[model samples]
Target: MQTFFIGFFGLAAVVFAVGVFRTSSMMRSALALLFSQTALGALFLAMQAEFLGVLQIMMMATEMSIMAIFMVMFMMDPGGLGGMDMSHQKRLSLLAGLGGVVLVTGIAAYTQWEGLASATEAAAADEQIRQLGRELLGRSMLVFETAGITILTAMIAATAVAVKVPEQGGSHES
Candidate 1:
């Protein structure tokens, strides 16, 4: 049933999200975050939001893949095989996380949620997605292209900054 799958994916997402924070390895943390995002996408799909589910999966897949690659390239020990401590400011982080949870819970409990969507609204949402796709590939294509180029430029700049050049008479160090 849809409810069962939604619950399953939701639980899976929460578990993987916890794994992201609990892991000591940068690579494992990135992988856990990826799994969490993918589970959230599955949750959306179980709830019948096709566009969001697919988008979440696709975007997170690419982003996390890039993040893992960067981690492997930049980290001294991305795999945590050396038993490195990856977390910092533990008390502050815990307090902040708890505060966030309390705030969100309060808001959710106090907010007025407007019931379920009707069939017509659902259809309109689907149509909106189609219109959005058209605009993205049509009038908004230039903007998207520009954004893509900007991101690529930033990535290149980061890579350049991260790279080290050897001296004329010295050897390069890993």
Candidate 2:
């Protein structure tokens, strides 16, 4: 059952991720990215990383919403109503993508990851949650701070992308 779910969402993640770039519309691309990230979150759940899974989904949902908003505000055809050309360097991208896959496959096949703890070593649910909290707020303070900074930066960038200077002779207020 676990294996089935893992494979299902793993495939879904790939499909939605591809959909992100395959679509012509910026809004649709953002939505596809959101679904791809959510699929990854489901995979994480299958592996029992519940906290990280939920965090992944929530962060992507927020980030993609912001991206869609900025696109709609800034782009002339956010919905691809003009049937804008979205494809670019297709053959080169495919070759590079294939090379990347081969490299990753080689690494996964040959690498020996050492000293990883088994799932049984982890505490029960409540204790695991407390441990995660302690690690995030205490020993992993830098990570938390970095995540906060990243979110702040994204918000700032969205505002910058979406906002336009008013015309000198025109009034924004009515």
Candidate that scores best on lDDT: 1
Tell me the lDDT of candidate 2.
0.89
Candidate 1 Cα misplacement greater than 4 A, ranges: 115-121, 124-128, 134-174
Off by over 4 Å in 2: 113-122, 142-174
The lDDT of model 1 is 0.89
At residue 56, candidate 2 shows an lDDT of 92
Task: Give the per-residue lDDT digits (tens) of candidate 2, residues 27-141.
Answer: 9999999999999999988877787788899989999999999999989999988888967898999999999999999998887755553444446667768998899899999
Locate the minimum summed-lDDT window of 10 residues in model 1.
Answer: 116-125
lDDT of 2 at 154: 100
RMSD of 2: 4.6
The root-mean-square deviation over C-alpha atoms between each candidate and the true structure, in angstroms, is: 5.1, 4.6
lDDT of 1 at 40: 97
* Candidate 1 vs. true structure, TM-score: 0.71
